[model samples]
Target: MALYGKLETEVEIKASAEKFHEILHQKLHHISNASSDKIKSCELHEGEWGKVGSILYFTYVHDGKVSVAKDLIEAVDEENNSFTWKVLEGDILEHYKSFRIRVKSIPKDEGSVIHFTLEYEKLHEGIPDSHSLLQLCADISKDIEAYLMGNNNEGSFIAKA
Candidate 1:
């Protein structure tokens, strides 16, 4: 059996770690301009928002295609301003066994680090590396930062009222 590895990417945001974390944890419908379509329709499946063990379900569109994913809140640390999620089920499972996102604050700065990790099962020998997924995560991070910083004027992915 092939042991799929995890891929991660991090970026610093221009908003306070608390603000960013809060926005990230809030109900998915609240975000007016998310970068990824998958994230735009996200909603808590059970329990309160940001609570560990809560499940979030959402439909995601990638490459003009749409699919669904159910993810569990793996961890949440308010003190460190970090949270993590693991995929419980999803359309992407054919190629991936699990995926996670972690966000942590940087001390002495109004910024935080957003990290994304994915563990995939090789579907074929031709399966390419997860660089595109990582880039997608980076784009999502940037969109979140822009939304929190009040710069998403055009209204792309985040929901608008």
Candidate 2:
């Protein structure tokens, strides 16, 4: 049997939903660090940006190793300011049965709130809790906020793409 868990974190951004979502998709390589070492590259595999069924190919490293996987865009709702992706093929599949990320926006004055959620199913008991992964997502969110707010000196996992 597999264990399923989810973690979420919210980051306040001094930007609009459209701006945030666009940057998240186009510049993910810049904000992700905790997983950056694992990810060598990412490219659009199919569909349009932020569209359902859009695919992304990711080359990543695990345990000092590198591998690649293709992910499917499961959902994209611009009105709700949310998007989700499911890992269809990748090295992560060995330990994670499935992985998904969802981002939502909350309206606020001057700034907006970006809520990030990660869900996964562990293949075995040896898998660590999702805490680190959640933290990684949070870090990415913060980096994105800082970049949008003109504070580009924030720490990041990957260089600008």
Candidate 3:
């Protein structure tokens, strides 16, 4: 088994790609309010939002358990509509040597694809890939799309007059 692994999930979203990118890149603190059950709070510790070297402390629930994670904003590319964060401290470190999450918005003619990627170097080969974590990320992406489109549900956003 390999010591390193990568997991990905892609979902098409009706919400504006720019809006979605803004939330992840600059307005992550509001995520907890949008989905209080999954993410309790996301607070900045260092640097500015959408800037490199910023530290974010996240209180969240995953896999039926609550945990805290401190992550560093590794990269923010507005041109690509992407954000990358590397885990610095927290429960995730206990399982992996290194872990990072990157989200990119790929625009199409009509809607855009919200792509989530998890790259990790495990503490050992016995550990499985971060599939569950990827699923968690996908679910959160859906929640964000729902909140932005004012749908309040996972079903596709139907425009209102």
Model 3 misses residue 98 by how many Å? 0.2
Candidate 2 per-residue C-alpha lDDT over 50-135 given as tens digits, one digit per residue, 9 for 90 to 100: 56788888775545466777888898776777788888988778878888878887768776888888899988878875676566
The parts of candidate 2 lying over 4 Å away from their true place are 25-40, 60-69, 152-161
- The numbered model that scores best in lDDT is 3
Ranking by lDDT: 3, 2, 1
Model 2 steric clash pairs: 33-157, 38-60, 38-61
lDDT: the better of candidates 1 and 3:
3
Q: Which residue pairs show collisions in model 3?
A: none
What would the per-residue lDDT of candidate 3 be over residues 92-121, giving only the tens digit for each residue? 888899999999998877668999989999
Q: Which stretches of candidate 3 lie over 4 Å from their true place?
A: 152-161
C-alpha lDDT of candidate 1 relative to the true structure: 0.67
TM-score of each: 0.78, 0.74, 0.92
Each candidate: what lDDT?
Answer: 0.67, 0.69, 0.86
